[model samples]
Target: MILRSPYPDVEIPEVPLPEFLFGAGFGDRGDAAAFIDGATGSSVTFDELTGMVTRIAAALHERGLRRGDVVALFAPNSPAWVAVFQGVLRANGIVTSANSLYSPAELAHQLTDSGATMLVTVSPFLDRATAAAAQAGLPDDAVVTLDPVDGRTSLVDLLGSSATPPELEVGPGDTAVLPYSSGTTGLAKGVVLTHRNLVANLLQFTPLGTTDETTRILAVLPFFHIYGMTVMMNHGLHRRATVVTMPRFDMAEFLRVVAEYRLNRLYIAPPVAVALAKHPLVDEHDLSCVDVIFSGAAPLDAELGHAVARRLGCVVLQGYGMTELSPVSHSMDERHPDDDLNGVGYAIPNVESKLVDPETGREVGPGERGELWVRGPNVMSGYLNNPSATAATLDADGFLHTGDVATVDERGFFRIVDRVKELIKYKGYQVPPAELEAVLLTHPGIADAAVIGVSDAEGEEVPKAFVVVQEGVTLTADDVMAFVAERLAPYKKVRVVEFLDAIPKSASGKILRKDLRARENA
Candidate 1:
């Protein structure tokens, strides 16, 4: 009952990540612009990028870092960030990327869990990085800045005098990047992606676009996110396209950069698409150069997608994937654009998908809603350091349970209906309910708490807390929200609070989230 990809199978190369990315056919594009700093108007050519990668790799090797060591990157999007990421790979080390907006506690958990030996970040985040490093039991020198500071070791200091890259044996099956994701339940875990997984995804995504040396791509999405890491940064470099990087997203600045650079391709989330559709600032700028916009990370409403496409007079498409699937399994083909705009489109090359009944464990046919099970070279190796979690996610038959409910049309297109997991999607970023509940329980006045996502006025899902207060203590919603706001990122903050007499739980003491969701909707 497994449904295969409509496209022909693609050849997945067995070489290491660095070799597959920078080897044989990538030469002669030396002078082409690889990445551009959107703010500073600075540019790095393909030849210079390769040389920087090698120098950084040599520096890392000289600093006593050996193959298989984990290096953490905690910086915003920039051309330099790209070099640092690729440099880690070229050094034969694993790269663990952290969200630039993370709080110190959040960062510390990732650092400790990933066992990162060194942390690389910018000066703006030095205070938080230092705090997190100390909390994680890393040395003072373990945290370094990307740029040269008065007293800190900059990335330049680690660069070796020689331009030759270090030579090391890296297998296709070796773990390359460790990106954190909350699979179906609980806190985030490190997703172990191998060299083969990344290379295969890159090859699989090639036919979906017409990117070339002349293509100018706007890369405003955070590189720490898997969608940006693979589709925008890695794919842009592999295609030798001109990529414009933004440190953060500002509506005015985003439009200015697009008009200034004449960027043609945009990779963004659903919320940004809403801005393009309804914001008046969009009409003030000249966005005629944009040819395509691809939305991912969350489901984009069909009406909003069409509105943006109509306003821009361009094609708008959606794709679907999780961090465990190298971030993309199905995307709309550039060659045959869908007019309906509801489906995320057909599976890309080399990936197969099937819809199954979650309760029955039996495959369902087209036009029936069921949990999606995908199998492909793009599937991750497993969750790092959590064999039980890995066993629960990746099956013996090699399919990764996505925990998302979807339906397939007769023509092979797929559309997401709902999520079966408790992870809330706040404008595409994951907000785990269990993590928020754990934080709420720490408050002295709170006896019990349960969190669930409720739709806001903007159609985006936000975290709402239902709390049970201590018998004689009084607490306000602001106090409850301020407590969480101090420890969590802005996106993970509790947006709404409701006090209850008691929390509904099972006999085993597990909070029934489905009951809370139903109450919220009712």
Candidate 2:
């Protein structure tokens, strides 16, 4: 059989997207704890949050922004960061959430590519922001500073506005969120997510909140990443559950939050699993409230998941999806547990998945391994400004061809087998090795650097770099890893390195990663 959805597409609401979710669930729960920001020790209620969002929309409208305009948000996990996002959405404007640590050049690339009209960022990055804004064709007035900055549109001023929006209509099909995907081999393309696309996925997993009332969830994954953005934050808020936010992951500090907040659910990536299995700090914290721990982005070793689950007295579950899919296509709930930890879990409701043989591009048997393709409302409309790429990734019938090598069992569970592309998923974040290779080449002392993903203790992969230095210059593995660390995001950091004489390449000069993996095994 060819790859076709046995089920039809999930229904999308024809109503205007932004205001459609107001007062739907969590009635009279506005005063309930919604977000507990760890960095500043601040807690915000649902009512407080919606009010802030409304003001943000009013201020943006006052500045002449209209529906479909794009705003860029570059900040960590803070209450303010989320408020800006909801404000952007509530106004019927889209937001591009950039990695906070991204270099000015990186920010400029995304801004220019996405044609963002405005930017909201922290005061600390003003200089870089200003320069990047110019490069992206934005004016000084377009820069909205989230904190006290001498010469910028203050976020406080926007928050103080009390004007009501024009009672506008929005719907699930309208574009609301614009997150970039580290395209398999090129520039990161903006993945357009309709409010309905995201709202649908959030509601699909809302039933998993059975214990959320008594359980606080650790929100360490970057909200900028779709998995963390929708799965944890949006879902947690819709459930009226408390979210304990961590701007950055610190092994020691992470364990402390669990004890401090009595956290019950931990939505983490594979690296955390590897650390918990051996990190001494895991033993010190009180994790009694932890009931379900879901890991994603990178692969999870069944052995490691089992060991960590046994040690922590919690259930370790694995999940799978990509940015183009509004992230979550499937996950292991309490019912399936570790039986399908290696698999992403059963096909989620409203989603139809298929496993196609690589050579023939035809569907395979229940136990056969192939490429996983999906058709659902959550699938992106297409890549921004790149029709060729959009056509290459999304099929004629709207099925997204997820390049992961996987197999689905008779029970509908899918397991990722290998990868067909050069993207590196470090703890659920895309760290394309080619991007790193391009950066490494700019260093004068470095003759060449070839980066590849190496398995961590938990079976997830991190970039392990092999470098060859200029004949006259002496270099060490430590020097190379640190060099990349200064330019990459936390998850994209290079953890291990080795000095190499040469990197295997083709006649046209493409790094042969499979050969490198084979050499590592040998």
Candidate 3:
């Protein structure tokens, strides 16, 4: 079933987004429970959350913050993390989320790039946040710690100042979030998402499929990332659905939550899907109740997508969106949701997507692979502080030139083939590493796989396979290469197989392709 755009054309709001998000759930007020921490069984109702957010907003406002201000949230996924997310919105400030797991160097880059004046973080991350702040030229007033230490103000105490929330001018064009994109070719760049960009996405998901008061979701996906921020946090709350938040994914616990909460909707990345489908432990846990399984951030193989669906008797839907797009431009229509269970089904409400040649701007026809370009309210305003990169990625026409090469079927179903910049040129024909990796995942013995291009003695780039074997399974390099050669085209075949314990991933769940490229150079 082709997903139809509800608006056909993206409808931009004249006002800012806090008004939209605030109004979305307040009516439920005391009745709606917003977040349920899966780990601790702790839950926060919408009214309680809004109260905390109001106090947080009041404290921040008293501390000299106002509209259009940029604040950074660098912490693990927890009730506090989410409270602060909404607090920033209520305070009329933009938020830039940094992963709690990031190294000082990685954290420093985003802090500096986004020009975040103040930061809210937990105790364990104080040193890293302090160092990053200094590097970013922020002084003592700029760093605020949530779990108080000697130097930092207590978040709880700060909230006691006033029950009243801050009021300021914030609009659709006024930036609301600065989520960094997982740049395929270079350093991660901050994608500027306005309040409209965010609210539009929340609305866009409304028409994608069936989501309402009855829907229950497993919110293990990181809130700092675009996918979880939009699909799990914003959308779930907008619909007044119960969100069972898992700080991290443990296979047994994930199944436990599904069974206990009767979780109907699940949004997962490719790696997690691989674990659910192939892991033996999955059998121990009953996932028979799941309604929607969404895989994004990376490609999910059709065989794997079909396997999970068949096992649970649930329709698997693959969605395609990026940090800049408020992340859900194409979600399968629930009516025909299973039609492209293997495909990233049709455009979401009010969003427009086009496939074009990477080198040339010319559009492609049905089934022809090309770089995908998207434009909508869901699309971000631009990259933070980097006009050059922003200008390069987003043309004057406002379409985000996503570097992903994909093909669309006649029915509006699309498949992300590989990254345009990451494609390996082998003997002049383009070799998609993702394609080879998908084939690698289909192998029974393989638990995880990442494909990168490496230079051969012949002075041409060749596909190299990095394989992680399943527990208790063993394989030789030649064996894995032979397995790939049988399935892939001659040029696209894996020429080298390197065994790895596991593939590295960013907090947002993107495989660090650049690290593999560095290893290739090594």
Among these predicted structures, which one has the highest TM-score? 3
lDDT per residue for candidate 1 within 104-154, as digits (tens), equals 998999999999999999999999999999999999898989888778888
| Candidate with maximal lDDT | 1
- For candidate 2, lDDT tens digit of each residue in 368-449? 8677888877788888888988899899987899887777766666777666575677777867675576456555576667
Consecutive 10-residue window with the lowest summed lDDT within model 2: 1-10
Candidates, ranked, TM-score: 3, 1, 2
> Candidate 1 lDDT (Cα, whole model)?
0.85
TM-score of each: 0.82, 0.80, 0.94
Greater-lDDT candidate between 2 and 3: 3
Clashing pairs in 1: none
Candidate 1, which segments miss by more than 4 Å at Cα? 182-185, 422-522
| lDDT, candidates in the order shown | 0.85, 0.75, 0.80
lDDT tens digits, residue span 1-522, model 3: 122354455455566665676655567445666788788888888788877888888888888888878899987677778788888888888899887677778888898888888988878888888888888888966788777678677687777876466665676778888988765567889998887777778877676678788888888888888888888888877777878888777888888888887888898888888888887777876677798887877678889898888777787878788887888877777766547555777777776678898776678877787888887777777887789988988988777888889888876777788888789999999998888888888898999999888888988898888899999988999999899889877878888888999898776567888888888778
Off by over 4 Å in 3: 1-13, 148-151
Error of 3 at 483 (Å): 1.2
Better of 1 and 3 by lDDT: 1
Q: lDDT score, residue 410, model 3?
A: 72
- Which stretches in model 2 have alpha-carbon errors above 4 Å? 2-17, 207-211, 422-522
